[model samples]
Target chain A: MNEKNTISVATMKRLPLYLSYLQSLSPDAPVNISATSIAAALKLNEVQVRKDLALVSSGGRPKIGYKTVELIADLESCIGSEVLHEAVLVGTGNLGKALLNYNDFGRYGVHIAIAFDQNPENIGNCVNGKEILPCEQMPQVCAQRGIRLGIISVPQGAAQAVCDEMVKSGITAIWNFAHVKLIVPPGVVVLDEHIGTSLPWLVGHLS
Target chain B: MNEKNTISVATMKRLPLYLSYLQSLSPDAPVNISATSIAAALKLNEVQVRKDLALVSSGGRPKIGYKTVELIADLESCIGSEVLHEAVLVGTGNLGKALLNYNDFGRYGVHIAIAFDQNPENIGNCVNGKEILPCEQMPQVCAQRGIRLGIISVPQGAAQAVCDEMVKSGITAIWNFAHVKLIVPPGVVVLDEHIGTSLPWLVGHLS
Candidate 1:
């Protein structure tokens, strides 16, 4: 907590990876682990891992290193993993449904509070225990729930409009899966998950 | 393709974004575009955009900038967007089905030729016109088709096992959606899409 605001985005992203790896360790595994061990396991640089861990946890001793349980608790607290951050998803297509059914988001403290779509047929359906509402209800529902995160899974053409609505509803963070580059106002954070780009990057590497 | 081998991973990743943006432009829009214009649109550095574009295309003029149509073709060829790269996806779960149903991959020249799952109920099912086959047939199908790219959407526990099978079946590149850091040989490439990390990063930034 000492350097919470000072943690770089790169380190912040790696915190989840470290937490997931530590959580994946067996119950019978060693209680104490060195940064070198973690870095080796995750195929990361040892010095970088040490620096990243130091920002979150102060339990690293000279030789004994960090206690697994304490490090996990510190990471969880620092990354806000213990807090339930609610988000509203717009677009109830296959990708939206997959995001709804994705249980891992809960582990990272993200819960898709509701989903919305303009299609009348999709509006009355239930996906992964959450009912789909009409697109008209998005702003009201998000504002009522005090949700700060808005997920845009709609097509490229509708993404900007959906994002504008979310911003108007006071959502500060947007996770955009649409292919287009979203234009957001200042102070609004948008994480564009261009899933299409990953494939080409991989293919281009192979060729 | 003059500096194809010298292109950095960062530039390779950005090529698709640039291509997508260029393709999104209206037909009546300007036929020429400068890196400064692109930088403004995507909120990137002008120098970085120019350097990235220069690596892919030689059509950029000093003042008039690059012609839209020719630049698009050069970007496409550089990113290998014209070649149909066939891939096999493992796991027929919600995420797998979503990827199978995702049509944008075709725009990026990636085709999910087939899918596999261990669940007997899903084995014979068809998702987005691609049939889900039994897990046992994975190696034979991948080998016979000379599949170099493999997608891992299976659960974390089963990921490494499936990755090993894919490597044994002649797959050299893996687009892993599972939350595990896979261990591959020297020549193989693995792109781990850690979708879970994005949410926490967004929440952390907002907090």
Candidate 2:
């Protein structure tokens, strides 16, 4: 089986942004959107947009723009949302709780299967009907649920220890929210959510 | 004084990650850390790290490595947190509320000056001691409080309108969380908190 269709992550990242901008346009009717238009919406270069679309195997005509609906659906299939992704979010703090309450994940075919914490006071309770289990049971619960995605929202102090345990329990990808950087072995994927980086742009543009 | 230093937004984004890893070592530190070590922490290429650091007018020495404390201090200074930044968060929904309660902003000198919402019920409220004002009073409140930075967490439908109002009210930079890519003019900077572009590393590492 040829994997030339296997899109790069950078291109995959652009898919959602494209879909989002396309969503603003006609959903039922296919509208041809130029690479320059998409690029302008995304603050990206026009050539970069064309290159990304080409890599995704999208249909684009000369002089005319790409069909919005077809491009969106093609990009969606390219990224593989065919399988429902069950994820477990650890650390039920402000950030974690906010994520649980966020309604958009279902549209992406990803759902928070469970939430856990170290505090016994939180154990046996439920937030958004997802059981809040003890941190000790993470391995058991993760295995039982067949969870592959892990979202870490623990404080900096406990983040590394939790990540090590998560990796051991078979989590392949982690959306890390802790301020600390987790050191994981090769083949494990860690998504570091650094909120501070979003600060400078805000400062530079505003000041 | 002639300014001799300039850094790209991409490099600035990774500084926090490097600094935090250095902080993990604390007073007892490694004599030198290779680009590979930095790459491991960020799930990026060592070549990328070397290229980025090289642009900052400093290179890691062969024998002693980059001085940990000095490197961290330089990264901080490069980010320019000499004075605390004052930002007002508009539309205190789940995201804005989450940010208001976030405790980690102090290290970066980012302080939430105030929070505003369109709903009348949210007005006259206080989040983290910062008053929640009506959207109409933004211009006056922001000017009086010297707020140039703005965070937009409104619904997708209201994002552009809110941003226009913010810019009119004298906001300089906007950290957008509307799940939509904004088209801001050249003078203004718009950084999306969208996970599509935000979690690029996970897709590559996991694939």
Candidate 3:
């Protein structure tokens, strides 16, 4: 939360991936990880990895590379991913259920305390131990819990409405999975995981 | 596919998102969309959007902006997303099932012809009209079908083996959704869709 040098969102988005890769590496002895190894693991250019890491104060040694413990701590604090963030999911669709069932979010400090759905059939149900409540209760629950992150996995048509409700209920950030561009008031950050867009690029490289 | 000035993979990855936004726009008259508008919609910087768009030969007007149709055509051709690419998915897990059920891959020139799973229970099942086969048959099926793009949604432990199988089966590009890093031979592209990593970035912006 410290007001440090502003890091670009692109760089910030990649730091978690780097952290994940570093976490996967077996920590033994000095744990000097080169950017080339990190780049190879994450499918990133080594030069770009070094440049991104340079944004922070820590610099890698010539032969030894970066210290694992220090680099992880720096990145975790830098991205604020170490702090537990309570969040609520707005949809219980297939994608929503997948996200709710995905237990790895805790590693990144994200906890979906509850999920809401407009579908009456899904109300009062539990997914991955998280209760599925009525959509109407979302705003109240979010406001009461002081939840900052609102994840929207509803259909594109319903994404904006859910986003607006989250914003109105004091949610400051949103991780939208829907394919629509949501219009939100200022000071709210919307992180769109456009899972569909990557397919084109993957297909692009084949040719 | 044309041998134009090499575009960065990052830029190539974003072109589909731009095309998606363009596709959503109601093309009325000239449809001159400004970079600022695109940036606001996609949560990108206006300067970055302009710089990215500048990679292509087409330049936008000072105020009139770009022609929507022309931009879409250029991006589609640039990424080769206009042509269909056959792919085989490994792992019939929840994430794999979600991807199989997702019908939007056609828009990005990706078609999941079939899926393979190590789980005996899931081998005979079909998801979203795609048949799920035994993992043992993957290499043969991939080679027979001439599949170039391989999608891996297996768990972290099984991911590398699956990647090796895919590579042996002649798959050049892989779209891995696993939580671990995969090692592949030269000239093989691996696009990792780290679903968990986004949570950290989303939470990061809150602080």
lDDT of all predictions: 0.85, 0.73, 0.79
Order by TM-score, highest first: 1, 2, 3
Residue range B1-207, candidate 3, lDDT tens digits: 333226665666677668778887775744677777889888787898887777753747888778777777777676555567889999887788888988878877889999998788998999989999998898898878888999999988788999999998899999989866678999898887878665655676777
Clashing pairs in 1: none
- Kindly indicate the candidate among 1 and 3 with the higher DockQ: 1
Steric clashes per prediction: 0, 4, 0
lDDT of 1 by residue, A81-170 (tens): 667889999998888999999877876678998998999999889998988999788778877888989899998889999999999988
For candidate 2 chain A, the 10 contiguous residues with the lowest summed lDDT are A1-10
Which stretches of model 1 miss by more than 4 angstroms?
A2-6, A26-30, B2-6, B26-28
Candidate 2 residue-wise lDDT, A42-155, digit = tens: 788889888878766547888887877777777666554455577888898778877877766655556788888988877787777788888878899889978778889888
Per-residue accuracy of model 1 over B134-206 as CA lDDT, tens digit each:
8889889987887889999998889999999999888998999987788888788898886766566677766
> All candidates: CA RMSD in angstroms?
2.1, 3.2, 3.5
DockQ, each predicted model = 0.58, 0.46, 0.47
**Residue-level lDDT tens digits of model 3 in A14-85:** 877787677767656446778887787777888999888767536578877788887887777765554788
Error of 3 at B149 (Å): 0.8
Docking verdict class for candidate 3: acceptable
